[model samples]
Target: MPFVIILVVLTVPAAIFFCWYQMLVRKYKNSSFIMVYHKVDRYRGGLKGLCVSPEAFDRQMDYLYRRGYRAIPLGSLVDSIINKKDILPKTFVLTFDDGYENNYVNVLPVLKKYGWTATVFLNAGAIGQTVQYPMQPPEKHLTAEQIKEMSGRFDFEPHGITHRALTGLSDDEIREEAEGSKKVVEQLTGKDADIFCYPFGEYNGRVINLLKEAGYRASCTTLPGIVRQDADAYQLPRFEFKETKVWSPRYFFRNFDFYLRTFFAI
Candidate 1:
């Protein structure tokens, strides 16, 4: 426990340095960020990247709350981009990839408790299938009705129909992966979603163009960085919050300036 505690503590300064390097030293000085999550579960198998454990999750939320950060919905972010408006200070967007039912079972309550909003990227074909990554056991994806209900709190965007690797697919296949997802979500919810997430952050210029043709306002990747005004709306970078030993509330706060720098720094 102490080791975990220390690891978390040590990451604070490193995160600070990273912020300075990216935000202050970099040339692009517009600061915006989007945080990514996949699953929020208990720490198991010394897996340090799941963003697991309720206690750690609570601490992270508390840090955000105390910082007076607003957890804006992803749709609002899209609107901000189109309108070319400034995101308020300490503004952040929370997004969860893969519509894990646990998000409905677990993460939803936490967000509700904190009065936070997030976006859930769902894979249409995988709604009731076994998980492939990090080896989470089979679980139902959020049901259509369930998703509709949750959409009231969080935006439900498309990851894809089948969580396939986009880089491996043909142009037509890519369109199915990209355009098809938009259609699916729209048919189900009767609402048009302009937000998308690449499965595994796999993309190319063609994929980006396909996303635009599909009418997505923006898309998220697995790349680790923050969003800035000049940053490409599509292929926007996100920091994945893995359940690592190097996680702590202080570490998160110390990295705020770093994230700001990464997004805004020149």
Candidate 2:
């Protein structure tokens, strides 16, 4: 009887895990993935994982193209969600965070080669300056001139005036980050900055309300999951594509299988 009891305890949890895995698999299969990239350069001595080499970026784009994956702008995805329109299978939205100058130097050429577009979230305060975060080198973030030059190909949005977490700030501070960044981006690009990316993907209900009050149409988060029709426009999740997943064929398949198993497992 004791042996039977132990067996039941183990089996019950395993059964529950199995059911949850299956639900994730179904969700993944039906949803669209939004991929976020940071830097595309060959010299990521310390920031290896966050930076993808130019060659890897080109290869990944080629793979997506060869597989017939459609890369659409984030705004189109938002429109479909707002209007309750169906998102096609294999649809993806490419996003770049931090507005690194390499985005202009290395990323732009690859994107142009594929005739694709991407949305870049800029640190409004860091424009034309070499901003260094912990463990990251002093790298040149995008300048206004460079931004204007590529304005035709990429959509620029606010990533905050100072790249600080929104949840940790005062109400007025939150407003400054959201509204201030929006104004800066608009002045630079001659377009309304409707979308806001939470700096470091940190936000609370208050931050969301502040963004709404500041006239933001939507926001993106660092949460990892496929974007569904019922997803919150203010808290949309994105998949961060790393070099390991993009550069290795075996690793890519293994990771893809894991994503399916972990997200869609039912």
Candidate 3:
């Protein structure tokens, strides 16, 4: 009788978990993922370092490629969503924020192999500079030559004039960050710089208005959600790929609940 009771207790929970896993799979079946990445460099400070190893990135890209996933630029995805155009199946976007030097050295090679283009959001004021973080090694931003070289493959976009919290700035300062960045990045890419990513994913109404005035059509936020045609253009959500976790199938299955909550924002 005790054995029968133990079997019932274990099997019931296992069956319930299986059902929930199947449901999450069905819910986000058609959803598009806009993956956010920072430095594609050596790891430090663990996952909080916001760094994904190049080897892990290679594996993730290979997995996606094998699954028939196609990569697209952020602006193109936003335009289609805003204009109510049909979105292709199994499409994803790759965005690198903070314009790290490692992105050029590490990420670009993997992208070239896949014939993919990504968006790089640069802090216009911090060009050719190294940014220091507390208790971690200093990270370098992309240099002008690197930007120019990758401009054809990377859609260089404005992050800000300085990597400051836009919500804390005055209206004029916000405008400067927005308009000033647009001007410089357009010069670098020789194309329309219409997309903006908020510094540290921080923004307010003033920042949005200034971005619109600066001719920006869309912006990215660090919010967690899947992209749909009805998603807000100015407040797009993304999931950052960091080395804190290896993005293997076992990791995902084991942490499916955590991902489901963060990804779907439930």
Candidate 4:
């Protein structure tokens, strides 16, 4: 009985560990990780998880740089997948949601420091608007001028005009939101607004069709996972980089391990 009990304890943990290791391997191998960030600020209010401090952002970028991860634009990733090219090792795409002024102020410098660029999804109605979400005060979001200034380092895309959930709107309304925002972004940036990010990550078949009609080549969702070659272009998943545990090396690894284990079940 004693021998049997010891064997069971050892075997159980060993089996679990082996399974977890396999999951990690599967999760990272031949996959491109897309990380989504919202506000890069020192603000303590609102959804704290959505706000990553500039210092933390710098450290995270430094970590990626030290680890030899290559930051690629989302458009390049889409083209590669469409062309059936193998995703390079340690390739990652950085995305920022919400056209917050802080993103230009805090996030841009860090990215520029590393000579990297990211995709920013802009809420068409919020741009140049004084107020921001969670009832923040004016000048919260990026202005048209600010966006143009940062065009060299950021690829701006539409995040819906009013940031409404596309799934809840009627077909015509969805088309207006999707197509209108795309046009607005293109007008402001003088570049094709080829990508869309579903506001609140809420989408459906009709919404997807609307985005396609609007000339969007791809869209991003809040769904958590590494982007595989076979993944849907409109429903691409992203890893939300929360500020809570991302700063701690131990906690970050622990959370990452948990994410891999949870998403890639054996």
Candidate 5:
């Protein structure tokens, strides 16, 4: 009797939540959100909380597709907003920071299956080389050749040259890290890198100006919120799945709360 009572309590809320989500799936069918990700590897390394296993990533992609969620480029989303155009609903901006080699080796194929593309904010300094860390194993970054190869499925944007916080740098130093990396990616991709993300999600007024001077159209921050029509382009907010339990009821509650406040003015 105790177990049955507990099950009833749980199932009731779950059923309500499921129905709510299905309704939202239709109501917000034309809305957009930016989703953050890092490595898509089976790597079980320490300090890899941000990494998603390939199998899990594949499953997540499948879930998103079935839910009517689709991926769009960051530039395209920003352009639509800037041009006063309506965004395609059920769309999200797929963004990966640090531009890990696993993106090419792992993430690309999964995205290809879904007919989705991603935007990778590259650590411009380590382009075409291995990324070395103080107390961690060396990880290779996306090389120029590999970047070119996957150009069809990826939009490589500038993160920074050294992956440092731009708020701590002087104007000239910021330019070098900002504009310099922009130049590198432009030359490699042969397309103007308009949208970028703040390294470590750090930026300030000075950093914003430096980025504008470098000709960036917008910047994505780690700030947790939905992207709306009136969102500040410089301080654009993004959200990430902090755990592997993608689409669980827990996340549904989290997103539902945010959706109420953002869309319904809770």
Candidate 6:
């Protein structure tokens, strides 16, 4: 039995090769891939450090251009996942959470250069509200007017009323967080927000249902994974792009196993 187990382990590589050969004999199959981004800025004070830098962001977009990755809007992504439509190999969606002013100042130009459109999730309460908690700083929040102007160029969605964590809140609180932002955005932009991005990517079944009740077509989680046909649209997963772009190669070329852990069973 010990020798048999050892032989099985030795034969595993051959088994994988056989399977690879069979796949070559059969038609190759590819799945849809989606990538998510948060902020794009220099590594410094506050939460801006977590976002991708201007140079790195440019490089990433350039790489995609050279590689033939076509950009898609968040709405199209929701439709594709919900309808189980085939996404091209060179297709992806660019999204940003928190609606930081840098998105307008820095990231917008880069995206414009590539003719790419990204989805920005705004916290209605924080739209023009100043941050008085940790530090006193003034950052523009893509004002209602700016949001409207940017409409034809990008998709503006809802994050929450105040970017509060919903995982520890009650059902009503969760509903308020989800529904309130949707209403605020709809009123501000005169366009209904169909997508919701969970603040800090924290949510559970209650939060999910509350988002649905709030009329959100889909919501994104910070969990890293690929969008598959069998995956849940409400808890869709995403990978955070860093300021350094050190892992862009591996991240952009993620495989099925990575998606399995990041998207499903979350």
- Give Cα-based local distance difference scores for all models: 0.74, 0.84, 0.81, 0.83, 0.80, 0.72
Model 4 TM-score, 2 decimals? 0.83
For candidate 2, list the clashing residue pairs, or say none. Answer: 21-265, 22-265, 22-266, 24-263, 24-264, 25-263, 25-264, 25-265, 26-264
Order of the predicted models by lDDT, top scorer first: 2, 4, 3, 5, 1, 6
Per-model TM values vs. the true structure? 0.79, 0.82, 0.81, 0.83, 0.82, 0.79
lDDT of 5 at 265: 21
- Number of residue pairs clashing in candidate 3, backbone atoms closer than 3 angstroms, sequence gap of 3 or more or interchain: 0
Kindly list the per-residue Cα lDDT of model 5 for residues 1-266, writing each as its tens digit: 99999999999999999998778655554346787888788765655557788887787678777766788888888887777677776677888998889999989998899999889999999987887654446788998999999999999999988988888888899989888889999999999997879988888888898888989989999876667655678887887765555467866675563445334321
Give the worst 10-residue stretch by lDDT in candidate 6.
257-266
Segments of candidate 5 deviating more than 4 angstroms = 1-30, 244-266
| lDDT, candidate 1, 106-214, per-residue tens | 7888889988888899897776555555454455577877787787678888999888888888889988888888888888878887888998788988888887887
Worst 10 residues of 3 by lDDT: 257-266
RMSD (Å) per prediction? 8.9, 7.0, 5.3, 4.8, 6.2, 6.5
lDDT (0-100) at residue 214 of candidate 5?
A: 88
* lDDT at residue 112 of model 5 (Cα atoms): 90
Worst 10 residues of 2 by lDDT: 257-266
**lDDT by residue for model 4 (1-266), tens:** 99999999999999999987887777666668788998888965766778788998898788777767768889988887777777777778999998899998998888889899899999998888766565544447899899999988899999999888989999999989988999999999988998999999999888898888879889999987777777788888888888776658765663573345334431
Q: Which candidate leads in lDDT?
A: 2
lDDT of 2 by residue, 1-266 (tens): 99999999999999999987777656655457778889898765666778988888888788777766767888888887777788766778889999999999998887788788889999999999998887887888998999999987799999999999999999999999989999999999999899999988899899999999999989999877678887889989887778755547755663463345333322
Give the better candidate number (2 or 6) by lDDT. 2
TM-score of 2: 0.82
lDDT of 1 at 122: 87
